[model samples]
Target: MHRMKEFYLVSDRHIRYAMMKAFFDARMIEGSSVREHGVMMLSLVEKLKDLQADFNKEETYVDVILQSLPPSFDQCIMNYNMNWLEKNLHELINMLV
Candidate 1:
């Protein structure tokens, strides 16, 4: 039973790591391409948190999301307030979605 639990734990960690890598490595898809992927990735992130995954900080995740945005978002990025950016990342994500 203990070994089975350990195996499950390792498997969960591996899955979480894979998802995180995929999200970070991904570029912004053209049009609405990233919306679905973003939603799925965000869901996976929330799920991994439930499993006690040592996820990256939300600020870093926000930065990654911002960077993944297309050139059209450059204006918004330039206008972004770093403090508000950290606090209102969901708003930014919603805009993209």
Candidate 2:
């Protein structure tokens, strides 16, 4: 566990991820294997870098406001998700009849 924490202390994100992978590969932790980590862990690094880039911006009111807006903001007409149930119970009843 000490070594795991030491590896995570490194500034390089990729190295941290690799160390995490090694820890999981050795079957050290339960309910969480490296295969289940997926791209989300790496995405955390990317999100941090993006925030850093946004922080680096040093400027006055230039004629442009560079901001990130949701891609489906105004274009979205519906926010609900449908499962479209197949009516399995009804099918079973029809078969009995």
Candidate 3:
């Protein structure tokens, strides 16, 4: 019998590129699309996985996304701490919707 381990290759450049792209795309979210946008952004941020040292990056990303929303979202933003570490992205997405 033989045992084998599998490994996958990932490029730093690709990861960085993806992160930036997702960040920019999330920033572009607005109005009625906030739900779908939040979902996508959440997925993108989660994809960072081991590439990110801590949740700070995700926190900043969510903060920017919230700031980019229209005035209607002001109350939610004000009521919540916007601390990604304290809140789950799925909950944020639900609130946005």
- Tell me, by TM-score, which candidate is best: 1
Error in Å for residue 52 of model 2: 0.5
Instruction: Return the TM-score for candidate 3, rounded to 2 decimals.
Output: 0.58
lDDT of 1 by residue, 23-75 (tens): 67766665756567567656655655665664467766667777777787777
- Please, what is the TM-score per model? 0.63, 0.21, 0.58
Expressed as tens digits, the lDDT of each residue in 28-81 for candidate 2 is 123443233323333433443443422232221000111111233212212211
Question: Candidate 2, residue 57: CA error in Å?
Answer: 20
Runs in model 1 lying further than 4 Å from the true structure = 1-10, 33-37, 81-84
> How accurate locally is residue 57 in candidate 3, as Cα lDDT from 0 to 100?
53
Give the per-residue lDDT digits (tens) of candidate 3, residues 3-91.
Answer: 11113354665665667676655553345677777776776666555455235555676676676677777777877764433556677
Query: lDDT of each model, Cα atoms only?
Result: 0.64, 0.30, 0.62
> Which candidate would rank higher by TM-score, 1 or 2?
1
Between candidates 2 and 3, which one is better according to lDDT? 3
Please identify model 3 stretches exceeding 4 Å from their true place. Answer: 1-10, 50-58, 82-85
For candidate 1, the per-residue lDDT at 34 reads 59
| Candidate 2 TM-score to native | 0.21
Q: Could you give the C-alpha RMSD of every candidate to the true structure, in order shown?
A: 4.5, 18.2, 6.6
